[model samples]
Target: MPRPVRRFHPLLFVSACAVVLAACASERTLTPEQYEQRLPALEARAEANPSNAAALRDLGEAYAQTGAYRQAENVLQRAEAAAPDDPKTLYYLGVSKEGLEQPDAALTVFARYRDLPPRSRFQQLMAGRHGWLLRALLRDELAALVAAEDSLTAEGVTEAIAVFPLTYQGQDSLYRPLGRGLSEMLTVDLASVEGLRVVERLRLQTLLDELALTQNAAFDAETVPRLGRLLRSGRVVGGVLDVQNEQLRTDVALWDWPSEPLPGLSSRQAGLAELFALEKEIVFDLLVQLGIELAPAEREALARVPTRDLQAFLAYSRGLLEEDAGRFVEAAAFYSQAVRLDPGFAEAAQKNQEAQAMAEVAGGVDMALAAPRRSARPPGGTSLVHNRLTLLNQNLGAHVVPGDEAREPTADVPLDPLGAEPIPDPPPPPAGGN
Candidate 1:
C-alpha cells in the first residue's frame, strides 16, 4: 500500500473547491435573525482568540449591527491594529466613529479610505463619503469664519489665492459657460505654482453664494479685496472675458487683498481656438507679477493642457455649472459627455465618477449597507489547509463538514450585494450630443 501511494492532483483539488464554493454562495443569506443568533458564538471566538483580527472584526461588525457602537469601536480598534490597511476593518471603524458622533475622527478614517487605490465598489462609496463629510465640515467652518470676518488679517492665509468666475461680457450665450470653465482652469494651473495655496473652486463658490455676493453683482476689482477679507485670502484674482467675432480678450487683475493695495492688471488677446495657449500666458504673467519664481518642474506642469478638444471642455464646463447648482444628475450627464468626447481628459473622468458617486449618496444609499462583507480566517492552532477550507466554506454558506471543531459561519455577508443597485443610468446625453 505504501509503494502504491497515488500522486496528489492539484488542479483537480482547485476545480473541486471552486465548484463547491460556487454552489454554496448561491445559498448564503445572513438575515437579521441569523446575525442575532451568531452574536454569542462570534463573541466566544473573539474572547478565546484575542489577537485574531478576523475574529475581532466579525465580533465588532456583529456589535455594530446591533447598534452597540462603543463595544464595536473597542474590538474594531484591535482589529485595525492587527490588520492594518484592511479596507473592511477601516470602513467598519469609520462607521463606529460616525455612530459615536466623532466627525473629525471619521473624516480621518475615510480620508485613509479615499487614499487607498480604487479597487472595488466599496472604495468608490468611501470616496463619496469622504467628499460629503468634507463639504459638511467646511460649511460649518465657513459660518464661523464669516461671523468673524472683521477679525481676519494678513497674519494667516498669506500664500492663499482665491479665483472667482470670470465676468462674461459677450452677447453670444453659447460661450457663456466659459466664464466658469476659464476660472476653473486658472485655479488648477495656479495651484501648480510652488508656495501658493489656491482655494478650491467649489469652496470659493460656496462661500460667495453664502454671502449673497454672487446674486446681483459681478466680481470686479473693487469687490476682490472685500471677498479676500471675508475668505481670509491674502490675494484674490478676478477677470473679465470679452468675446466678439470668435476672437477672445481677457482682462485679469490680482488684488493684494489684506493691504488694500492697488491691484496689478494684465490683458491678453487671442483667437478662441488658442484658448489654452492664452490661458498659459495669463498664468505665467500672474506669477511674475506676484514675484513668484517657478521651479522648472512647476513650469512644466503649468504648461500641460487639460484638454485639446473644445467640445469636451465645453461639456465639462457645463457639468461644473450643474454640479455647483446641486443638480448632480445633470452634472453627471454632462461629465459623461466630456469623457466620451475626449477619453484622455483625466479631470473629466474623475469628475464624472465623483458626480455619479455623489448622486448615489444623495439618493440615500447607505455606504455600510452597500458594501459586501468577506469572511475572516480563524485564529491560530488549526492546520493551514483546514483553516482555509473552514473560512472558504463559511463564506460560501456551507455547513460545517466533518471539521475538527463545530463552528458557525460568520454572519457578515451582505444579503443583497451592491451590484443589485446599479449606478443609475446617466440621463441621455444632451440633445444633438452637445
Candidate 2:
C-alpha cells in the first residue's frame, strides 16, 4: 500500500470529492413532510444560538411552510437583524408581511430586497412582487374608500383631478384602444398645469378594472363622487369617444363634487390625422372649464405630444389595455411594437420595459398570474434580466444558503419553482407573544 501511494493522482482525488458533493447536494432537497420532521431540531438550534442568523432563518422558513406567519415574521426579523443585508431573510420577511395582509410593509421590504446588490439572481422575482402588491393595494384602497364613503364629504384636494378612460361609443374595435390612449394623453397634458394635480393613469386604470367597466359601459353616476373621494380628487373627468367618416369627436364632462352646479361639458372635433392637435385643444378646453388660467409655459408643456405616429399611439393604447387586464406578456409585445414604430415614444418605451420586467418576474408561475418571459434577445447571452432568471432557474439547489439566496420552496413545491411558496395567512399570535 505504501508503494502504491507513491503514485496517488490528484485528479482521482478531485473526482472522488465531486461525487461526494453531488450526493450531498441531492440530499439537500427535502419533501414537505421531511421538512416538517426537521422543525423540532431547527427550532432547538435557533433557540440555543439566538445570534445565529442561519439557524433562525431555517426555523423561520419552517414556520412559514406550516403557515405560522406571525412566528415566521418574528423569527425572520431577528434573522434580518443578525444579518442585515441577507436577501433570503428579507424575502421571507416580505412574504410573512404579505401573509399578515400588510401589503405596504411587504412592498417596502420587497423594494429593499430588489435594490440589494448582485440583483441578477432575484431581480425578476422582486419586480413581480412589486407589480402584484401595487395592484392589490389599489383594489384594497378602492374597497376601503367605498366602505368609508358615508363619512366622506365632497371636500377633497381642490386642484386635483382624475381622468378616467373614455367610454368608446364607436363600433369599431380598432378605435376601442383610444379609450385608454386619449385619457392618458389628457392626463399627461393636464399635469403641466402649475396648480393642478393629475391622478396617475395607473390609479384610474386599476380602479376601472376593479369596477369591471366594459368598453361601452359609462361611469356610474352614483359612483362618481365615491371615485373622486378614493382618488383624492375634487374633480373627475369622464369622456366619450366617437368616430365617423374619419372624423374623431371627443366630449368630456366634468364632475366637481364640491360645487352645487357641475362644470359644463367640453367638446373637440378634428380629422383622425390631427389627433395630436385635437388632444392639445382638449387639454386647453379642460383647463378653461376647470377655471384654471394656464400660464404660457404650461401651454408650451401641454403642446408637446407623446408621439406623432398614430400607429405607435394605437400600439401603445393596446399595451395599456393588456396591462390593465394583467396580460403582461401581450402588453409588452404591444409596447415594444409602439417603441419600434416610433423610437422617440418615451412612454411606450417605458411601458415596454415595465411590462417585460413584470413578465420576467411572474414567469407564468401561479405565485403571481402574469405571463412568462419570452426574451426579445436570447436568454443564454449577457442579457441582465435573462441572466437573473436563468440563475434562479438553474442554480436553485446550489445557491448560498440563508444569506444571498431566496427562500427554498418546500410545501407543495411548484412545477417551475420561483424558490418560494405562498405563505397563507395565519391566525393572530397570542397576546404579549412574538
Instruction: Identify the leading candidate in terms of TM-score.
Output: 1
TM-score of each: 0.70, 0.66
- The segments of candidate 1 whose C-alpha lies over 4 angstroms from its true place after superposition are 1-50, 153-157, 215-218, 260-265, 294-298, 326-329, 362-434
The positional error of residue 133 in candidate 1, measured at the CA in angstroms, is 0.7
Whole-model lDDT values for every prediction? 0.65, 0.63
Model 2 weakest 10-residue run by lDDT = 400-409
- Candidate 1, residues 1-434: lDDT per residue as tens digits? 11111222335444545654464355333444555667777776777678978777777777776667899899999998998766656666777787788878977887886565453444544665667767767777787878887787656556588988988888877667788999999999888776789999988888876677762253564666656766667777887887888688988888776666755557889888788889899899889978988888878988999897776777788779878877654465556666766778888877866765554344221334323322212233322223333443343221212221112122233211311211121233334432
Residue 194, candidate 2: Cα error in Å is 3.8
lDDT of 2 by residue, 314-415 (tens): 878977988888866556656766676678888887776666557544421223221112221222333323233233323322111111111111112221
Q: State the weakest 10-residue window (summed lDDT) of model 1.
A: 397-406
Q: Choose the strongest candidate by lDDT.
A: 1
Model 2: residues >4 Å from true position, as ranges? 1-89, 113-121, 148-151, 155-158, 213-223, 229-232, 260-264, 291-298, 360-434
